[model samples]
Target: MGARCSKFSLCWWPSHIRSNRHDSSDVDEKDSLPGFIEYSLDQLRAATSGFSPDSIVSEHGEKAPNVVYRGKLEDDRWVAVKRFNKLAWPDSRQFLEEAQAVGQLRHMRLANLIGCCCQGEERLLVAEFMPNETLSKHLFHWENQPMKWAMRLRVALYLAQALEYCSSKGRVLYHDLNAYRILFDQDANPRLSCFGLMKNSRDGKSYSTNLAFTPPEYLRTGRVTAESVVYSFGTLLLDLLSGKHIPPSHALDLIKSKNFLMLMDSCLEGHFSNDDGTDLVRLASRCLQYEPRERPNAKSLVTALAPLQKETGAPSYVLMSIPQVSSSSKQTVPLTPLGEASYRRDLTAIHEILEKVGYKDDEGVANELSFQMWTNQLQETLNSKKQGDAAFRAKDLSTAIDCYTQFIDGGTMISPTVYARRCLCYLMNEMPQEALGDAMQAQSVSPDWPTAFYLQAAALFSLGMDDDARESLTDGASMEAKKHRN
Candidate 1:
């Protein structure tokens, strides 16, 4: 993951901001990150509806360095797919090298990479979907209630930690650490985008769009170092404090004259303590220092913010009194542990009911009876699962589905993830009824699995059961929230 942090983050910022700047876009891809998958272009196209316009997720729309699209895999898992412009990487190997490097990073405060696709002219990077949207939306474009002081402090701390983690891993050049690069997870925690690290392009251009957002040194030297990242971080601090894009120079002027009240966001009135605000102001001032060496390192920034971290049991959404997740399907529901044994019992009950009233296919032996031969059956099932996974990665839906069915038909093991994957494939094939059945089977296997409910919701929606789909979506969302809360 650290390798990914160094690669993708470097590619992220300058790529987005480049206009007349010196291009510096070469990526060193010697490092290997664990658990990163190589996705086929067809799979990405299927996931993102052929890179349709409706899937655009970037703030600047299609005109940016890379376009982002929201997508869902065959497993009902949501992801954000970033596709670089055609000219960004003329060499396919260069693009893959950059992507492979970025795909290695994984951190709680950073969006984790799911996979990458490098086919012909296409260079795509897939990462975990953040449902709560970007920090810019919640701050500047705030529609709901204003963000609370505690939540802001939390966001600051989380961003600092993310930067600290990246810097510690030798990924110190975060090209643009702005509000747009900060996203909120399902739990409403702030996640620093790995996309801020912009790699030097082949054309020698270093930066792009919105020159006002660029650090002074970047404009002068056309290069970024560790200290340059601190400058961007300082600019971000200003954004958080003012709830607007105040120039760093202007912000420094305000800070010098003890005119913090004027610099602070009016919407945050009465929420923060005077001392805390002053402390943050001071820190931001230090970060905005003209001389690169005068700026505090990410580690030092984290240390300074340590005392300001408020200890409260309240989640971010609650503290701000504003919904974090954008989904209308969100629900408030408490959760508790349902042991594995209980889940197995549920699966047995469901199987009995399904056999009695639900659809049934001829398979000679009972699933329950099949489990007695666990030793050989489990191994065979695992092998079939591997084949299914490989087929799924290759975008061979029919073959993948067949493989999964073979695994499930064995019935020696209960894997909700497998059921969910097959369920999604069924949905993709326009077999909503089968998808719904698999979703139910998944729930029976692992009743606490949030994704099973979501798959049920998707299947229901396809079948025109709008109200039921809404209910299922709500249940899934609630379960997801519960998982995060725990």
Candidate 2:
């Protein structure tokens, strides 16, 4: 969660607004938040042509997708579709969870939540669709370029105002305020969306919840404080100002450079206003302070950007440098106590989550079983790479074999999980042939792992291929030695 502040008290948000004419049931009791519309699952399915893959609007690829379905309401108004991945999906309980937590805002800078659908096993949410996608798509790319200086502030002000409104009027925290989530309407107004990552202090834990947007204190303590949000907002401001992803891991090193120009989106083509951008740079720097106390509150952040709102016009986004992630650099955190799942870089864990959701509507029983098995295989692949002691690591091989056999039955698209664990388990069982076969498979999946090499060597040794075993053993030993050094 981006929001985390227990010491700083947030004031009434809608500091500059009037109430919506929509129904009151949707508003928060404390602040009378904005109203929302609702839609049924049947209506959404029809609009999306039965929720086909072609209807997908924005995808984070393979995993978290923002599938868009074009549908008309009973009254004939067109609505945009949002088919969320299962983790971010709202069941009946989560529907109100988001609305109550952060969906009550009525601002030009924020998107309106229309309604949602939660059929027996399917889940989807709906919001007023902004024709233009996220500012991120343009601002963070090189070939696409950056927005004009004046335009950057315009977007920044609108977002600051929205953030201010959330803090003051709604009394909620938008724990995830990344550049990728803000949407631009037809008229170029930024409508904030996706409160699926929000947390409510009124719920009483007093700590923020979203991790990518949170600081260490919030992570160390299970408190959802308002200050945490201030920190997150600061990070957002920094991203808007600098035009780069402020990874908490590299935040310190980047800050040490004090190179605001390096941080600013280079795509702006040198169009930013001199004084205004400087001020924004300073404010953004303050918001991302390592010390929570050093960060400004929501009111201060809004006040800092107030002057820049005066120099606005057609919207343009800043072009910041995009961070490059190695193909295999993705992390794998255990989704939950076997109840939930999240995205991973490799093909692993994709099926476990599908099984958890368990589609029952139209698919055949055998297909369902095969799907479940494939998902199980993905989970096994994930578990194989997790951090554990050598003793505990031994069990991962056997577990992976079970998972691989299930998917290798030729019922799924994902690759088999058999090869990676073959050597380890074969070594355990003294079966060189099975070990060699699996070692080859493991190399095909991820050649970066030294385990596959070591296992192949061990298999060769058992097969009496002394020269091959010696060379492989040396390579494997070197890799293991490097691993130990790290």
Candidate 3:
């Protein structure tokens, strides 16, 4: 008997699977993608701690058809370990094929597959764990403040781009798409789950999917096509518009009557302009059209929502930091320096916020720091930067790294020059991974700086990504040339 047919009823024996990163170039073109890892059963069991109950993450708890567990690999990376029901994937090879196909999909808006384990009858998939949780949690059952209007618009664009990317890759049939499948990454950006593609092949029954969110065609025909995915995307748009889960038919009625105000989430009362609201509502209305052929494709949807993206350069966390409306009134609560730092991740913004709302004592006194203490800390950060600059000039790589790291960790106002200088330090220290992270962060803070790209190329080259490094170097050179030309 094959591993898939091994005797195990209902429950899958927890496998101890070891994860190994597989290079794309080494993969047989017919089998798997570059990053796909096939873990040993031992590693999987160890990572999930014998698949403990604590690992289960689904709202249905452990009672759901398939259970998802949060696990940590030996590399210290967090991942979601989803163990599928035996019946769902009776053929292990089929599951692997589909998984490998989805694994090849790489998009900023999509959660890429990390690895999988297939030992005996156990069929498990591992994916990057999103720290910010799901869209459904933030929308209907918000714990913190409501998601901002700008953030919602950004989410819409992101989801659209994800679908567009998947469809372009020929993985057209996305079964039972919903907000729950969309997770928020570390930066508060939305990432569509790769598991969304690995669901049971189109059958009449839609298991565990919210009926209200399901497209009418799926309910009637018991099949999913490319067009059917559009219908599901339309429902997701409706969810963004109304925080509550309103059925497509009912939402259509609200749209037809031009009672969009009633359809809009009460928490988003003043944040959005009427025109923007109307535009999104109109787009949703088109998406919810009964006939699959009548619904717009993901490409068109992206095009339509492109204009609604107001803050293209704003970090996702910063967008979410905007004060949320409640009871038809907008509120602006001043944030603490650390709170601002946590959201904006921009040193300049953090410093400005700190200055505007200076350090406070227990009684909320302004300028809590005495002159000497404040000056000492500020001078320390500046001195570190200056030392780092001096060391870099002298090619003292180790000293440059130490000073740059101190300056960055000191939490002073962020300077692009300092980050660029530190990134070079990291590269020279033979820490390409750290160098890449700093280079990317620098780009995030000062997007147009070609020096960031130049550093990124060096880091990539050091990391053994020759082609990618060359591309980055080319981009940096071109940007620098353009800048000089102007």
TM-score of each: 0.60, 0.51, 0.59
Which wins on lDDT, candidate 1 or candidate 2? 1
Superposition error at 258 for model 1 (Å): 1.3
Report the C-alpha lDDT of model 3 over 1-486, residue by residue, as the tens digit.
011111112111112211211111122222322488888778977877788886667734333457788766776556788886655667878878887777777666777787888888778888877756689987887644788888888888888878887777787777668888999765567878988787563222443456766777778887788787888787788888888878888899888998999889889888889999999999998888888889899888888988787666666756654211111111111222233232223333322432343212112212244576577797887799788867876768789788978976876546656665666666656677887788777666666555556566566666877545545544454454345335
lDDT of 2 at 368: 34
Better of 1 and 3 by TM-score: 1
Q: Sorted on TM-score, highest at the top, how do the candidates line up?
A: 1, 3, 2
lDDT of 2 by residue, 63-124 (tens): 34445665445443445676655655345576556654444455555666656666665556
lDDT preference between candidates 1 and 3, better one:
3
lDDT of 1 by residue, 1-486 (tens): 011100111110111211211111122222422377889999889988888886777734344567788876766567789887766668777766766665666666677666888788777788877766688888887654667777777788778777787776667776556788899765667787766653643422444466776767778888887887787778787888888889877788778788999889899888788898999999988887778889888888778876786644566645653222223332222211111111112223322332242222122223453444775577888799889877765557799899988987876755666776677677767798888888787776566666666567667767877556545655665566556435
Q: What's the lDDT for candidate 1?
A: 0.66
Best by lDDT: 3
Off by over 4 Å in 3: 1-34, 59-64, 199-210, 321-486
lDDT of 2 at 39: 58
Name the best candidate (by TM-score): 1
True lDDT of residue 72, candidate 3: 66
